[model samples]
Target: MKIRKQLPISALIAASALISTQAMAEVFVAPFGGYSFGASDFSITDEKTDELGSLKISESNHYGFMAGVTTKDPGDIYFLYSHQGTELRSGGSFSPNVITDLNVDYFHLGGSLYFPNGNLKPYVTASLGLTQMRPGDNYSTESRFSMGFGAGIEYQMTEAFSLFADARGYATFVNSSSALFCDGGDCLWSISSDIMWQGQANLGVKLKF
Candidate 1:
């Protein structure tokens, strides 16, 4: 998949807040769907993929929702939940003849700051929470602490409706000292525990309360 990383922190936060009233706005909800891009290959097990081999995960689409409070100062404090997955491919001459699957579920406490314009809003977001990775079949699952950030723009359609688009990245941290899988006296690193990161492009509709 062809994907470009977009990392931008608004340089005009102070300059753009001249129109704020500092009053609290009502609650809001944003439901979104988008395409997910997987990070570069990494070993699930302790063994370095360069020495052993690599597992390639196919980029797939994901969907999620956010519930938050939008303030007149142009900020959002929201809870976000997203579902993501990919197909697993191992790099080797003799590949395993098994169908493997990979999935991730994210639960985050996220926040955003927007350069609020009359009808066009540009924003940046950050979040930290839990990431759960499930490898298909009987493989043990991996769950770890994760963090992510994003930037986007929103265009208001009416007093209570808006459309927005954003690009974001989430990373899961799971490290091991030694391989978790052992075979006859030889141990392979854990397949369920590894550092993983994912990027996404999303478009969603927001409803104001």
Candidate 2:
């Protein structure tokens, strides 16, 4: 992929230097668990030709995990990791009682630049990582991968700890399809991977070292 002039090489280098220096201060690792709610949808495009179809799915009420490192001061840079997942049940006859499980697993290796002087430390964090979604049943499953980014705020209690929350979204790219069911003669039904989008709201605590 070619990076445009808007994302200059100099800016990239500068950000790298910043993170390197920030890492030296003090690093604290915290394991956080939270609940997530979202939704999912699906659609089918070409009935013939490629037997191609699309799925639009949005679901919520799931669980998530986050692990990160924080600095000693209220306003400093820190790195973090996060994850979320859930399951959906299809309704009636066609419903197939099919369970649609969407799991978002993210390995984020990024830093947060916080504003400590304010009543609440408002920070902007950007992460470049891999996101995977798994839609499956008791016997079969399918998965996809994509990149993710996040930004939010953190409120400090003491210099060593605080409460924080953030809203993060992920865009995924995966090729999906339904299995072909045949009754000894003809093809019954088929489904295909269209495209999917996922968004999440995270609430947790930041304990500084």
Candidate 3:
């Protein structure tokens, strides 16, 4: 279930109004939790290419933290970390005991372009990071290169607090590899490293000091 998602363009146009403006430089921290949806599917088949069965990960939730500074022109440079876990369900009649826990963790550095001074601020964000994926117990973690971008708005609620919402999608470059459930030299299915994506609609709070 790989769905290619395009970055929202409407918000990019809205945020362009701040290009010529100036903003403040300050430190802030935001801790957020939100619902997340997984879109990665693993299928099993005979080595000769016969479709045997498949598995899909279920929707899950995520929580993370960002801490960084607001610089001139109101841009933000932040460090981020997040965790998500999903359950693998049978998509076809593979193996009943093949159901397992799938987990992903992200460690990234992000930057955003924003308007300096406004009750309602629009911004665009892009980040480059590392993603760690765990398929099941006793298996080595898979590390991959990941990147994401999106746009959103933040409304100042007080001198030190603000509310924000954004929609973004991330792609993990998994490439192609042998399955973790393979037996001996004969594997059931070969996984493609194409693009494993997850889309997020998040609501959170930012505290500026």
- Full-model lDDT for every candidate: 0.76, 0.54, 0.75
Poorest stretch of ten by lDDT in candidate 2: 180-189
Question: What is candidate 1's lDDT per residue for 15-99, written digit by digit as tens?
Answer: 3554343335668999999998866565553344424545565788889999988865578889999987767666543263334
lDDT of 2: 0.54
Every model's TM-score = 0.76, 0.59, 0.75
In terms of TM-score, which candidate is strongest?
Answer: 1
What TM-score does structure 2 among the candidates reach?
Answer: 0.59
Backbone-clash count (model 2): 19
> Candidate 3 — what's its lDDT?
0.75
Expressed as tens digits, the lDDT of each residue in 64-170 for candidate 3 is 88899887756789998878887666666665444668787888899999864569998999999998877675445668899978788999999799998887788
Worst 10-residue stretch by lDDT in candidate 1?
1-10
TM-score-better candidate, 2 vs 3? 3
Supply candidate 2's per-residue lDDT for 38. Answer: 43
Q: Clash totals for all models, in order? A: 4, 19, 2
lDDT of the structure predicted as candidate 1:
0.76
Q: After superposition, how far is residue 25 of candidate 3 from its true place, in Å?
A: 2.5
User: After superposition, which runs of candidate 3 have C-alpha atoms over 4 Å from their true positions?
Assistant: 1-24, 43-53, 92-98, 177-189
